[model samples]
Target: MTRKPPPDTTPDGHHVVIGGRRWRATDPAIPDDVGARLRVHLMAARRAVGVALRAHDPEAERAARDRVQSAKVALGERGTPWWEQSPEERRTRWQDGLAALDAQGAQGAQDA
Candidate 1:
């Protein structure tokens, strides 16, 4: 029978700890400055992705504006550069933003 390992370690024996019910690797701790900078970069990246997705999904222009605004709220208008943001954050924001734009465009076309 498969048994659950202690919360301090993974089933495979990797050292991990539960924080807020999420598993985190105990080794290789992230520095506070690095984490803070990462957050700033993430916010900028989210905005840039929304902009790029707007090109393909013309209908999403409005939502793109909203997303850019949210990211701005988190990172501010002159926060970290979008180029420095992580790729994963950018991709996720893009997928959601592009879909929103596509829907908006389709709805507009239907109305016309």
Candidate 2:
């Protein structure tokens, strides 16, 4: 839900404008920290994929990069933001990605 408009006037004697309408802090539908952390997680995930790409095996690296891209799209569409997602959801995604990476690494090891 959106924040209710504040009855008080803005500094210029106008209603606070946000998202094309007046807005207030009361019942803030979104949190600053949540957005910040989501960006951080997204950055970290991107970095992980980059590191994976440096691997010697081009095919394995491509798979890891693809997984990262898919994860990023999913996170963006979640609406509530990644950091705001429940702990279980976050942990599950992390574990799944890590597992995929581990598998790729193991395959590389076998090839070596």
Best by TM-score: 2
Give the TM-scores of the predictions, in the order they appear: 0.29, 0.34
TM-score of structure candidate 1 = 0.29
lDDT of 2 by residue, 19-104 (tens): 56654221122235543444454565567567766766666566655655544433333323444557666555545544554465
Scored by Cα lDDT, where does model 1 land?
Answer: 0.46
Stretches of candidate 1 off by over 4 Å are 1-80
Give the alpha carbon lDDT tens digit for every residue of 9-78 in model 1: 5554333566635443311223355335434544544664676575776555555455555433333222
Lowest summed lDDT over 10 consecutive residues: which window, candidate 2?
Answer: 23-32
Assess each prediction's global lDDT (C-alpha) against the native: 0.46, 0.49
Residue 6 lDDT in model 2? 51
TM-score between candidate 2 and the true structure: 0.34
